[model samples]
Target: MSEVQELTKTKEKPLWYVVFTYHNAEKRVEEHINSLAKTEKYDGLIIKAEVPVQKRTVSRRGKIKEIEEKIFPGYVFVKAVMTPEVMAAIRRINGVAHFVGGGNEPVPITPEEVKRARIQDDLSEEFKAGDTVMITDGPFENFIGKIIKIEGRKINIALSLFDREMGIDFSPEQIMKIQ
Candidate 1:
């Protein structure tokens, strides 16, 4: 309520900034930023760094595996009190290219956009293995296939392509029940 208190509150308020990293370096950048948060230079100024990811099922060589895929590749979200020194330090981190939203001034991410980026696709309860489905998106759109495996939010389907059965993995939203 006091002037000094108000100043302190506004100064400490953290906003989410988007940092662009090199190809396949989102995780590394996030870790580096987090590690720097504990050091004297970044203490309090840097709050947290996060790379949004979702669990996906992948099929390779007849083996079904779950993998965590980045929701937004090459980007990491960082919560921090924006300061010139902090921005410079982030840019200096290895694997981090620069902050998004133009040159020196970086824009903070909107709360809505952050929420959407963090949302995880839920597995459809109505779908199960052996169920016939129709591909709704991607290169196999409208193609009919049979569910081969259900792992987490990924649905492995067997589709006839070029007269041969090919195994493919899709998110639940990409396929619908044939019935």
Candidate 2:
């Protein structure tokens, strides 16, 4: 027998695409998609699913609560090979509105876009009571104040204006620590 030539077919490459789901149902839709893919044995097509979220601190009645907020509401990012079977499987999941791109075709997002969408909290810096900070923006621009209270991004600062100490709220973007 002569030499035999074997022909092997390659599968489609996976790319990151954005999926639009019901409002406030990103987590649920992700779970459902994952469950469906697993049970239906389409795990190779649907590689990964994620919902970009950010930690936010909210203060109410003197109590501060840390909550995880989705960076993109009603949207979830999925990395997969967009095959007809994979698309059909995703459509069957509840709470899944449709892919971000119109029509049956879904568009892939750039890696840079994915990074930008993921809003991570920078916890390296900390401000405490009596710490001096400079107001960088807003009405208190160029003014110096002492930190009265620190609630995540919101800082309650006491500024001396006209010989009177007044407390004002400033976001992390509006203040820089001096000491």
Candidate 3:
């Protein structure tokens, strides 16, 4: 391997970063930042630094589909402490133009927010459209529905009124979700 490529492989991975403002520099910045990670091993502290990425598809006519990569671009996240040395090393890296939300001091990104961001970044699976649902949202405040039909926000439910089995049409707000 080339000397440069070999050097690249020795870099440490940092986790949990609050990278800010790479808005259009995801790819370039990853390479640049990772390279810097090696040139300056701030410490044995870097965890896993990365720019989260995901893909999406667009449907076309004739049932045709095309896949595309979505970039949250211009954001670099590093999973490391904000120690003077580590922060100094990160600042020295390319593509990391600034910290998240913008401020002079180093800001730590919360794990919860980061987890939610990572989880929602991609839609792995969709709701099964479960057997028709029934919910009563009006005067029939105590009513609920099974599987009927949903149009816009209107849901038709098969609810038992009094003691008679029947299908009632009502807004989801009027009904409560029950087993």
Candidate 4:
């Protein structure tokens, strides 16, 4: 390639950067960036917005269910040529917390890390608070409990064990919802 062509190519090439968004708001933020990129000004400056997710399987009442989980909750990856205008536009989107970099400038994620983060890990099961479930793994295996709270993959349950009430936390993969 000619020197000028090489220079322009390098300048226009997009790098992967991480952006923070409100928990569970990755899709919204991605759509917002997509709309903005379509505008006349940001057309080529912003390239892609992605939310990496994985499929999981869980059993409930003898039935299995597949669920999609975010690999990095509250964060999204964007491929774009870093520029003041592009950054500002992304920052202005609702639900965007900020770029992952702590300082004044944004830091791009390494190509290797980006590749790893994009891999989908499959798992099983989904449950909600107030559902009765049975532990399938961990120390409480075979114990029946009622889900009292759910935070990401962790589940807090209230169970009656040894004639007393106890509260414990477990991962969704370790418990099965029972009707």
In terms of lDDT, which candidate is strongest?
1
Name the 10 consecutive residues with the lowest summed lDDT in model 1: 4-13
lDDT of each: 0.79, 0.73, 0.53, 0.76
**Number of clashes in every candidate structure?**
0, 0, 23, 7
**Candidate 1 off by > 4 Å:** 1-10, 119-179
Q: What tens-digit string does per-residue lDDT give for candidate 4 at 18-111?
A: 9999978899998988777678898667766888989999998999999998899999888777899999989989999999986978898875
1-179: candidate 3 lDDT, tens digit per residue: 86434433453222356666545766666666556555546434554466766666667785756564544556766655456677776676665677765566666666476665562321111101234332323565534446455554455566677888776666433443322
Taking the tens digit of each residue's C-alpha lDDT, what string does model 2 give over 1-179? 31111111233445678889987888998887666656547755776678888889999899999998888889988877788888887877778889988677989887578669872322223457888777767887868888888776678999999999999998665766562
Select the stronger candidate by TM-score from 1 and 3.
1
Per-residue error for 37 in candidate 3, Å, reads 4.1
Clashing pairs in 2: none
Runs with alpha carbons beyond 4 Å of true place in candidate 4: 1-10, 119-179
Question: Arrange candidates by lDDT, highest first: which order?
Answer: 1, 4, 2, 3
Stronger candidate by lDDT (1 vs 2): 1
Model 4 gets an lDDT of: 0.76
lDDT of 1: 0.79
Between candidates 3 and 4, the one scoring higher on TM-score is 4
For model 4, name the residue pairs that clash.
56-123, 56-124, 57-123, 57-124, 57-125, 58-124, 58-125
Candidate 3: C-alpha RMSD to true structure equals 18.4
Q: Using TM-score as the measure, which candidate wins? A: 1
